[model samples]
Target: MIVAGFGWRTGANLGAIRSALASAQQGQPPVTALAAPHDKLALVSPLAEALGVAMIAVSPSALQSSPTPTQSPASLKARATGSVAEAAALAAAGPGAWLLTTRHISPDRTATCALARSCTEGPAQ
Candidate 1:
């Protein structure tokens, strides 16, 4: 399964979220789900619906253990993750998942996206 994860600032609109995901998805497999912090489900729900993919709410505890390729001071300070987008994707993709891209920022700079692929190939919830 391929998962696309997002991290966004307050007031980020659907356009910004979509732009970031598009940028991150370049050369990647089709995304089966969208993910975001459990506390921030609203951040990714709209995009998930627009993409017609499943939504995965990642827990803070899960983010804590998932290592990311990129570091964002704000993300690290606020969520204990080097990159919220990367961490969310890795966590939601489950065991043995690896990032396909680090993070891609939206044109508006209000959102970011990262992609990760699961080790297993069956359907994902």
Candidate 2:
């Protein structure tokens, strides 16, 4: 399964998120699931509905525990992670999953997205 994780500034519109997700998924497999911080379910729900995929609300601890290739100073200080989008994608993709792309920023810089592929082939949670 392929999961796309997201990170967005407060009040960012769905268009910004869609743009970032489009960049992240460029040339990649179609995403079967979506994920974001547990506290940001409200922000992700609309995207999930639009994409017609399941979405996971990953905890902050889970996001912090997941290692990512890209590091962001703001995210490190605020969320104790490198990139929330990368970490959420890794976490949601479950064990043995690997990142397919690094975080991709929206044109407006209001949102970010990353893709990860699950080692096991099946529907994503």
Candidate 3:
């Protein structure tokens, strides 16, 4: 499975979320699931519905524990990671999953997205 995870500011709209997803999916595999910190479930549910994928709510601890190569000062302050999008994607994609896309933010910076592929799958056949 490929999971796309998101992180967004409060009051972020569907447009911002859509833009972030578009940026993250460029040259990437189709996403099979959507993920975000549990508190952002309400914010991401619409995106999940639009994508026709299950939305996975990642725990804050899990997000913080997941290793990511990118980091932002603001994200570190808020979630103890450089990029919540990357961490959440890694955490939700299950053990052995790896990032397929780094965090991509919308123009307004209200939303961010990252993608991860499941461990059970190899590169595209």
Candidate 4:
């Protein structure tokens, strides 16, 4: 499965989320699920519905353990991770999943997106 995870600031709108997802995908595989930190469920739910995909709420502990190559001081301070989008995508994609897109921020910089695919496909290209 391919999962797209998001991280966004308060008051982020659907446009920001959609823009970030588009930037992350770049004509890649379809995203089967949308993921975000549990606290962000309210924000992600609408996006999931719009995308017609399931939403996965990743736990704080899982986000911390998921490795991400990028680092964001703001995200690290808020969620104990450098990249919430990347960590959430990896967690929701389940064990052995790897990142296809690290993190792509929206034009407004109010949201970010990351993509991950199941390990069954081997390492992410």
Give per-candidate clash totals: 0, 0, 2, 0
Better of 1 and 3 by lDDT: 3
**What lDDT, from 0 to 1, does candidate 4 have?**
0.92
- CA deviation > 4 Å runs, candidate 3: none
Off by over 4 Å in 2: 122-125
The sequence of per-residue lDDT tens digits that candidate 1 reaches over residues 1-125 is 89998898888888899999999988777899999999889767877887899999999999989998888899899998899899999999999998888999999999999998898865333
lDDT of 3 by residue, 7-125 (tens): 88887888998899999999988999999999889888988998799999999999999988897888899999888999999999999889999999999989999999889887654
TM-score: the better of candidates 1 and 4: 4
- Which candidate wins on lDDT? 4
Estimate, for each residue in 1-125, the C-alpha lDDT of model 2 and write its tens digit: 89999988877888998999999988988999999999988878998998899989999989999999999998998899999999999999998898999999999998999999988964433
lDDT rank order: 4, 2, 3, 1
lDDT of 4 at 4: 97
Kindly provide the TM-score of model 1 when superposed on the true structure, using C-alpha atoms: 0.92
Off by over 4 Å in 4: 123-125
Candidate achieving the largest TM-score: 3
Better of 3 and 4 by TM-score: 3
